[model samples]
Target: MVNKLPLSGETVIFTSTKKSEEPYELVRQLGGNPVSYPLIRTEERVSVNDDERMMQTRNYDWLIFTSQSAVAAFHHKLKRFKMDVQDYELRVAAVGEKTAHALERIGFRVDFIPDVFSADVFVRQFNPEGESLRALFIKGNLAGTLISTELSLSVDEWTVYETLPEVSSAARIVELVKDTTSVTVLFASPSAVTVFTEHVAPKIGWAGYTIGAIGHITKRALHRMGAPVHVMPETYTLPELVQTLAGSKGRN
Candidate 1:
């Protein structure tokens, strides 16, 4: 039906392997097009070596989780330590509602959750006024500087997850961009946008496509790569992105 394929002529690529049908449906409703092209691939960077050490202590003042993946990976590592949920006594703080929800499902009480779900916001909420609190940050290896700069607290970071490039997908994307007359690439993260543009720059050359970023950070990444980001949402969320595209249906 015409209603289901509102995005019939438009071909947009999603960055994650995970499928977000809401955006596709929204694009279809607006007579645009949508496609899936995962840029970054996720893999657990956890190991038994780190788990063996973490299990020996309960001195951390807080356990901070940045992403849902970090929470999941951290829990997965805990399973190898042969420990129950009672092993951790520290206060828990999470970056986003979704991350907090993941921790809550595992029966850990989250003590602090910031209003906004950005690195800068999370940093601002952390206390510099308190005594030196030993905080443990569970995040990706390539995390932003907020954790170190904001807290001024004694902190340790572990790379529970690593975001690597999908080399094959990147090539396919380049081919897709080169073959198509026009395309619109949706970028949700600065990292994804950076890697995407860097690899496709020489080949695609932006002849028939425009870049779309989720927010200012991602938009900035696009700029650093010398790629112009045309569509940016006022608020950052998957649903917001869908609505933004739905409002402007004429893009090819």
Candidate 2:
């Protein structure tokens, strides 16, 4: 007996910064057709102040990375400045598994990852006392302010990238979602959710479609934008979200 895949004959629309091959391939592996249209784009920003601060990396006690983009941007900046990351004597803190993996890929020894995979969770769990414990936060310009504001350590933040809305043609997005009874829209970030809501929500009504949020932040953004979310995995990862959506076929 040939067992059918959970997401067989379904179409999933991915709205994020870029069309990643891994997620698309994963969706195909799960027997689903993946349509990728980035509604947000990430532009790496050169922070002169941060570049100067990078020279003094040894002074910081901890280096925090919230997203994979941040890790990539920070590493790119380091290479551009002719800095050797391996020489920096700093403990690294990554927000989630993906972010940690990104750091690990670049030869960084991640010292901490919170139980929960959110900035709020990371900040609350990483309770650093005193201003003497200086931590550098490498993040995007659109990042939430909660982590830096909440962390007890003296924080030095560097905006290494900016996320801007990259709305595609309404016709293109509409065509991608055409005639799909259960088009699962995947949102990985708050910016992606915001852009989708602003551009695509009006054309596609809430009926006959399912929204899948990758994490708490994305889910909260959907709620704030008045978009319905049908699938949100306990684990904030692409694989888990895809699995949750596969299992959420019959559920409202």
Candidate 3:
């Protein structure tokens, strides 16, 4: 006899960007009804000195990426200027495995990935000797300054993408949250949590559903807004999140 899927007959909601197909597919494979209700969208940010900034990447010893979106936006800038990734001899540091994979896809060798995927752990564990290092942080506009502030090295930040709330999905999100049955809502970023709090929480309130955050920062964000986090994986990756949720189904 075949074993039943872990998430059989459950509904899983994805609240990040619509481009997140991996986790969505994982949930589907686990026999959950996956829904793509993106609560945040990202757009590449352009500046008058973008060309010059792209050229200046060679000055840094390391390129730090915290998210796949940052890596994608950086790659886009490189292609726009007809620049090759090999032209810069900068080493790479990524906060998560997915971010490192994104860097590798663009021909970058990731030199560092902290044991934990959060920025606070990254800062604590990275460069423990307090060695002077020059790094450029490729991030979205909404990213916090924890890395720049806490790291012992000189860090320059490049805003390659801007995350905006996906207001259009509010109606759909309202409908989903209204149903309390076997529904698990997953949040990958604090920004997504903020969007949900501002737009959806007032309408439906944080009841009749299971909430999951991708990392401690996002979990903290949910707590700040008076929402309980039902599931959070030890490793802050999309695949891990989905797997953890699937495993939790048995416990619930």
Reference-based lDDT, each prediction: 0.73, 0.81, 0.88
Error of 2 at 143 (Å): 0.9
Q: Relative to the unseen true structure, what is the C-alpha lDDT of residue 177 in candidate 1, on a scale of 0 to 100?
A: 79
lDDT of 1 by residue, 34-56 (tens): 77878877788856587665674
- Name the runs in model 3 displaced over 4 angstroms: 1-3, 128-132
Q: Candidate 2 residues 166-222, lDDT tens each?
A: 866445677767766657888889887777777777887655677899888888888
TM-score, prediction 3? 0.95
True lDDT of residue 85, candidate 2? 67
What's the candidate order when arranged by decreasing TM-score?
3, 2, 1
Candidate closest to the true structure, highest TM-score = 3
Score residue 63 of candidate 3 by CA lDDT.
86
Question: Which scores greater on TM-score, model 2 or model 3?
Answer: 3
Q: Taking the tens digit of each residue's C-alpha lDDT, what string does model 3 give over 143-212?
A: 9999888888899999999999898887788887676478888999999998899998999889788888
What ordering of candidates by lDDT runs from best to worst?
3, 2, 1
